[model samples]
Target: MLARRLLIFSRQFVNFTPVIRRQFADSASQTKTVKFISGNKEFIGKGKVGDTLLDVVVNNDLDLDGFGACEGTLACCTCHVILNEKHFEREDRTNPAGEEELDLLDLAPEVSDRSRLGCQIKIMEDDPEVIEVRVPSVTKDQRSA
Candidate 1:
């Protein structure tokens, strides 16, 4: 009976080993790093998978405008920026621009296909390469204010 019990325990241990190893492997695979470049500036931020672009910018003091106005609420498009082509492709899906954001973007001077509110973009750090985005001038309202 003791031998039978030991046999059952051995089987359970064997079965659990792969599960433990897989969990560790998955966590290792999910680790991510973030890098930002705007014109002459560049920075690398150590981030997990779900960090927002604004989070990195805020933490790094990336000289983005509108950040002081809206406080990252997405209320004002002062943090308007253009995502570089390489960084644009790294985003998982294009987050749909809300009516409020669209209206705010209208207040931005140089709106384009690549225009995005920095506060609205959440970074997906799954890619192997660093992402780059550019901060544009402040919105008309912010500039005048």
Candidate 2:
């Protein structure tokens, strides 16, 4: 009797394994495309398509103001933007912020848990269909006394 009960539990656990795996895989696949929305503007960046978000931002000449300040380099915090939660979760392809990037983020106003440097994020060959980010209005220096 104990052996039969153990077999039943094992079978149930095994049956649920694929369901759990599929959920994880689906979440990952859904994160490839990046869709950025700020204010009333909405922009979609095609992922796994050999084009970086910076490239799209510049090519399209996005209305965002901070780009002119950074020159697309990681030097300044002007390119600071907030990553949507879904994008934040799939940011694994991009390198994590270094000490310098983190320091710069500290100088960005409205910095939050999803803060990321626009220049640091790169498009990956197998990324999701969309990722969303939000640009803030002010930098820390801009709010100074």
Candidate 3:
């Protein structure tokens, strides 16, 4: 009985623990620019430490069509992006393209050495203030029934 009670209590603690929120400076003060290579248009996005690239893009209304079609579910490669070489291999970034992410990259149009799913790229505390994103000029119509 005692062991069962302790296990239940531990599970409760784990389930009830609140998720810690990441904070960032105001968007006005620290506006991060997400540049689009195709249109040469730049949108401002403010990202907290844990914010994904998709989060920043959608939150700022950058007007990139066919983006986040899967809403970061990893079900499709709609948010496929090519990161500049400078940022793609940054040593400080905690997120790396895993095998599954790599496999999905093969489905994205114009896959490149620097291709990465925007949803998988999170803004760590030490990430650069300006992140350049390149949307492939062509996107496949991956709509499903």
Candidate 2 C-alpha lDDT tens digits along 60-97 = 66666456375544568777778867666666334566
What number of backbone clashes does candidate 3 have, counting pairs of residues 3 or more apart or in separate chains? 0
lDDT of 3 by residue, 80-102 (tens): 88888767887225446767678
Q: Once superposed on the true structure, which residue ranges of model 1 sit more than 4 Å away at CA? A: 1-25, 28-39, 43-46, 63-68, 86-94, 138-145
Model 3 scores a C-alpha lDDT of 0.67
Return the clash pairs for model 1, or none.
none
Mind giving the per-residue lDDT tens digits that candidate 1 earns over 1-145? 6774575456436544654565466775243455555446665665444445667667766555335376655457767767766555453254456576678889886777777776666554345556656665423565565
| Highest TM-score scorer | 3
Better of 2 and 3 by TM-score: 3
Q: Residue 33 lDDT in model 1? A: 50
Candidate rank order under TM-score? 3, 2, 1
Candidate 2 TM-score to native: 0.60
